[model samples]
Structures are given as structure tokens and as C-alpha cells.
Target: MLGSSDPQNARPASLDAIDLSMLAELERNGRLTNAALAARVGIAESTCTQRLRSLRDRGVIRGFRADIDPAALGLTLQALITVRLGTHGREQIRGFEQRVRSLPSVLTAFHVAGADDYLLHVAVESAAALRELVLEHLTTHPHVRHVETQLVFEVLEGSGMVPREPVHPPHV
Candidate 1:
């Protein structure tokens, strides 16, 4: 618990060593209890709690979620579907995003800048379901000009961390 007079309540210009350690530990396991995390980081439980609260308030710690296995949930097949839009209007983009997000098969969708307008990460049970999704739902839509799908053989997921500063080689 952070007291009213505590200096830590003030927003830090940059994260300190302890803050980085906390983030690294949390990235490894989001469900760690305050007491457990404190022990791991070699800090007091109250300080750990205050640091976590500060991180969350500053939007550094976005949100915690359970890492679910899609395969275990009967969504074994995965594909990256590239969609080219007929128009890149605001209304059209919003409509396409809304419709694509509505589909249960679509795990994530990105409105990207590349050869394609949108990239969709989809998971389904079988090839038949994938075909139906592509044909009946995507291609049939008025906004969708062209759709291409590439089957994913394997997916290697990460903690989604981006370093703020460039790393240089250590001097010998």
C-alpha cells in the first residue's frame, strides 16, 4: 500500500530496474500473487503492490488474460486471410472490421498498410469451415474485392514486448 506522502506515487519519467524486473516477471506469469511476486523480485509485498498499481495507472500494464490453447478448444486449424477491400473509405473500413470481428472463427483482425487492406488470423475446426468462411462470408461481402488465405503450419506466440531503446553490443 502506497501512503499519501510516498514518493513513488509521483509518475516516473522512465521505469527503474525494479519496474523492469516486475514487468519481466509479470510477462512470464500474469497470475502471480503479490506475496509470491514480492519474494521473486526480492521486494516487500506492499512496495510490489504499489509498483503494480503505478504500472497499471500509467497504462504500462495494459491488461491480464488467460493463455488459452485454441487447439484444446477444437480450433486446431489456423490461417492468415489477406483481404483486399473494394474501397478504403472510413465507412467501408469500419463496416468490414465490424463484420469480420463478428465471425467466431476470426481470432484477430488487423487493418494493415501493405498489398492487402486487412489481415485476419482465423482458427477453425476443418477445411470445410474455412472454405465456408472464405466463400460465403468474406468473398460474398460487397466491400471485399479479393481474399487470399495461407494455411499456418505452426504458430509461435510470444509475450508481445517491444524494447524502448536500441541495444548495442557489450564491450569486451
Candidate 2:
């Protein structure tokens, strides 16, 4: 969930070696305790707290969330649904976005550029459930022009968002 605009986040902040290391470590594991995080990042506990606060305030780090497996919750099937809009009216777009946010099964929604207006990643219990979701929540919507669904076979997560420039230097 993206947070509301914070003016502080609009401006960039200079992050040092210590900051980068902390971020990389946290990306791998966000549940680390303050003491553990400090130790891993080679910094004092007090300094670690300050750095974490700065990262949050600057919006460099959004809030951490539990990575849940849909299958564990009995949502066994995942699909990517692309939705085409009949009209590009502002109200229609806003209404569609609002409708999507109300759906419990939608994991992510992208307002993309191309033939489709929206791409939704959703998880459901079975193929029937997937079909129901597409027909009831999406294709039937007045503004929707066309709908396409593709089953997902596998998902692989990437090493998230680490800066390439000025790679974390070796500690002296």
C-alpha cells in the first residue's frame, strides 16, 4: 500500500555506505531486530535506529509487509487479467480503480500504457473462482471493453531495488 504524499519524500536524501548496507540486509530480511540489524550492518544500535527512521521519513523504504503465499490460504490459482477500457474518461478510470481496490483477491493492479488500460494480478481458489472474478468484477463493468486472462505457472522474486551506483564499499 502506497502512502499519501509526504513533502519530505519529494526531495532526495544522500545515503552513505552504512545506509546502503542496512537497506540491502533489510531487503533480504525485514524481520531483523534492531540489535541484529545494527550488528549485520556494522553500526551501533542507536545509529541504526536513526538510519531506519530517516529511510522511512524520506520514503526510501515503504512499510514492510508479510510475503504471504496464496496457496497457504487456499487461494491456489493465480492469473494476470488485462482489462481494456471502452473510454478514457477521468471518472471512468477513477471508478474502475476504485472498483479494483475493493476486490479481496487482487494482489496488484497496474494502470498500464498500451491496448489494455489495467493489468491485475489475482489469486483464487480454483478455475471457477477465477472465472467468477473476471466475469462478475471485471468484464461486466460498464466501462470495460475487453478482458483477457492468463494463468500463472510460477513466480520468481528479484533482488529488490538495490542501487547500482556507488556500490556498498568494503569496510575499513
The 0-to-1 C-alpha lDDT of every candidate, in the order given, reads: 0.86, 0.89
In candidate 1, clashing pairs total: 0
lDDT of 2 by residue, 1-172 (tens): 1232555445555778888888888888989999999999788999999999988877678889999999999999999999999998999999999999999999999988888989999999999999999999898889999999999999888768765355577999
On a 0 to 100 scale, what is the lDDT of residue 135 in model 2? 93
lDDT value, residue 121 of candidate 1: 95
TM-score of 2: 0.87
lDDT of 1 by residue, 1-172 (tens): 2222345574443688788878888888899999999998899999999999987877678689997778999999999999999998899988888889799999988878888998999999999999999999999888999999999999986645734244689999
Residue pairs that clash (backbone atoms under 3 angstroms), model 1: none
Off by over 4 Å in 1: 1-13, 159-168
Candidate 1 lowest-lDDT run of ten: 1-10
Q: Give the top-scoring candidate (lDDT).
A: 2
